[model samples]
Target: MLRKIIHIDMDAFYASIEQRDNPEYRGKPVAVGYGGKRGVVAAASYEARQYGVHSAMASVTALRKCPHLIFVMPRFEVYKTVSNQIMQIFREYTDKVEPLSLDEAFLDVTENKKVMEFATQIAKEIKQKIHCQTRLTASAGVSYNKFLAKIASDYNKPNGLYVITPEKAEKFLEKLGIEKFFGVGRVTAHRMHELGIRNGFDLKQHSEKELVHHFGKAGALYHQFARGIDEREVESEYVRKSLGAEETFAEDLHELVDLLRALDDIAREVHRRAEKRGFLAKTVTLKIKYADFAVVTRSRTVVNYLRTYDQLFDIGKELLLQVDDIEERKIRLMGLTLKNAGTDQVVLTNQPLQLTLEFKE
Candidate 1:
């Protein structure tokens, strides 16, 4: 029997929450983040998005796009509370709910507690509950698999609902842009374009062998995606792969002293969060972005879980020095992350590690 999957995505999660709680922010362009020289936009309201402001954009850049954009500092604790409320609503329908983030999740409602005959109805009810309970809107997509369900959810916008039935999945995917396929980033899209692959239909023309040869193992997945095939299940057991924090500097740093100081601050925050979550890991990764926007990363693994702030900072400093010409290159951003090193979570060889980065804007 085909599965019934529903993907629910909250509309403009952070920014929407702010607007819902603050009547004055409603219908106005609002951005959630610090409006400082070193700040990044964590989330942008739909109004702000109309002006090209988006999440992960520099605060200055967002301001330049929309000078009247209202900046609000993120209240993470409040967001978490709302997220929990939403998750509870998901649990009311099915235990097979896989959360991609606090704002979005995938639900396997084929055997839901409510025993709903149609996943679309489940999605509609869930969306209604969320809005009624939280005073916020959510968009939902329903399909027989995770891929189509996720894509359907995004096909429409805030407060929208869409369904991609099995009958039309292939034709729908054929017309979809190549860039819309999951795991295809800007770099991958450029490579696919060079090979004359611009849409799902062009992608279907290539054999699995040819695609695998061109894009490695991920190419095989792309071949399946073009045919509207995704066998991945909704993994309800949330296993966090990695956690990290990053900060961009107001000005580039070339001095070793300043770099180390920045690393120290970031490490301290990472340790605090890890300690709070009881996330013990044995690997440390350091990411650096140069002034020219080039990025590089270094990682060190140990046998024991890193338990202290000093341990995190010490490893971070070591990784910092490992970077080439640490003192000569101007660095724009730095990040530190901790991974399980295959100790805490079951390692899936076929899956890539997902790192969640909390930007300190």
Candidate 2:
């Protein structure tokens, strides 16, 4: 059956909120961060991004790029309030709403309440209503499936909406770069590039078995993704997946004993956080970062929920043996993660009928 999925992403979410609240910040290169020597940018305004300032970039570096950049510390509480407001807006039209973060979500409106004949009209209405309620801008993308919907949302950005029909899906993916494919991060991108795969078209050149041989389990996903096909459902109801902690060390620790100490700390931290949040997971993932900033991760699925410190540490220790460069290269960071396979509760609310908060000047 043809599905109607819409991906909505806010434009410069944190930065835009700051701009909206502070008149002086308008049209300026504003950033949200600690703004200290050791600080990094949590988010950058459109103006700041123009200066090459981006999220997670060191604040000192962002300042070098734009000497006049203004930093505003993150108000996560405020952001959460805004997120709740937006989620309310999404629930008005459909019960199937999946929030990716504070700024993005997917809506399975195939069986929506409004009975709207076209998803484009629904997208337009949602955009309009968001503006009405929040005085913020949002973009929407409509497609037959989740993958295409996400790509379509990015088709036009910052208050723009784009739709991709089934007929247009193949052509749409054809033009996309490998970097744009979901889950294809830096390391994967590099691997694909080495294999002469630069975009969706190039990826289609390889068969499923061939991709699997090279990339393990992720290759089967590659073959389908290359063909612009994703069978995953629009999961509006999702459980909290992974909860973990990581730290970037200022100096690389070359000693195995030192790395283990750091790993123990990270594991303890993850265990504490998970216990506090009541997060239960059957899988544990250990991530390592080398002095060169290169990263590797090893994960194992256990039969029981990872709640105790011993389990976290033991799995992490076992995985450490797989790394050959622990003593040769400096270990910059280590982390532990726990992933939940399922969830039980779903949030339901009203979807916005329009997109503007008020009339524009």
Candidate 3:
């Protein structure tokens, strides 16, 4: 069967929430994060992007780009609520939904409730429902597989939909930027460029063996991606990959004592979530944003899954201390998430779809 996959991503998730709640923020440049000396933009409205502001970028740089940028501290509780709303909408169609983050997810609808002939219609309906229910716009991608669906979703911005068919897949990928390829990060893109592999076409020139020799396990995946082939099954269930909490203070934190307390709070929250979910996370990750806007994460994966609050907090504390510029940097937010060892959910669907009656056990 030709698998039907759709990728849905909310447009400017955090910033959209801000715009939704505050009518004044509409059509204006707004950023979600502290605009302090050590601050970073957690999310930027479309207007802010026009001024060169972006998420994960330093507030200082964003300010330099747009002095009039309006900054609002993040309200994670609200974001989580919105996320739940969208997730519920997704479940109405298919059980095979894989969430990429709070605002993005992939749905496999080959066998769905609507059982619609065309995935495009399903995508359209989902988008419409989101707008009707949440008053927010979402971009959607419809294609045969995951990678292409994801690419299609980003093809249009703000509020858009794009579809890639099998025949058009190769051509569409050829024009994609190296940075746009899945799993190709800043470091990987640079290395690919150094090897004269700039785009999908360039990536196709190398043999699987050559790529494996050069890039290890990722090389094999890239070899297939170059040809628009992704055989990865859509996992219906997945263990909690990370457990962490974060807070954006109303006031910027500039002292070590205060920072420790925040970190402790976040770590405890992470530990609690992990314990509740029975997560086997070996890696403890700490993410921080300075008032100056520079954001960084330090993580150390232990041999065993960390379950206790003490273990998680101790590692997080060590990581916090490693940031030598902490005192000089005014912190606006701190986040901790646990990365569990790899595990995939097993689905049960191969059984016959017929009804059976039994008289005796």
Which one is best on TM-score?
1
Per-residue lDDT tens digits for candidate 3, residues 206-300, read: 99999999899999999999899998877766544445677766568978898888777777666665565556667877888776668999988
Full ranking by TM-score: 1, 3, 2
**Residue-wise C-alpha lDDT for candidate 2, range 219-292, written one tens digit per residue:** 99989987878878877655565667776655678888888888887887778776766677888877887867
Which ten-residue region of model 1 has the weakest summed lDDT?
346-355
Distance from true position, residue 115, model 1, in Å?
1.4
**Candidate achieving higher TM-score, 2 or 3:** 3
What TM-score does structure 3 among the candidates reach?
Answer: 0.80
In TM-score terms, candidate 2 sits at 0.79
lDDT of every model, 2 decimals? 0.88, 0.81, 0.83
State model 1's lDDT.
0.88
Per-candidate TM-score against the hidden true structure:
0.93, 0.79, 0.80
Model 2 deviation from the true structure expressed as Cα RMSD, one decimal place:
6.8
- Give stretches of model 3 more than 4 Å off: 245-266, 276-307, 314-337, 340-361
* Candidate 2, superposed: residue stretches over 4 Å from native: 247-272, 282-336, 339-361
Candidate 3's displacement at residue 113, Å, is: 0.5
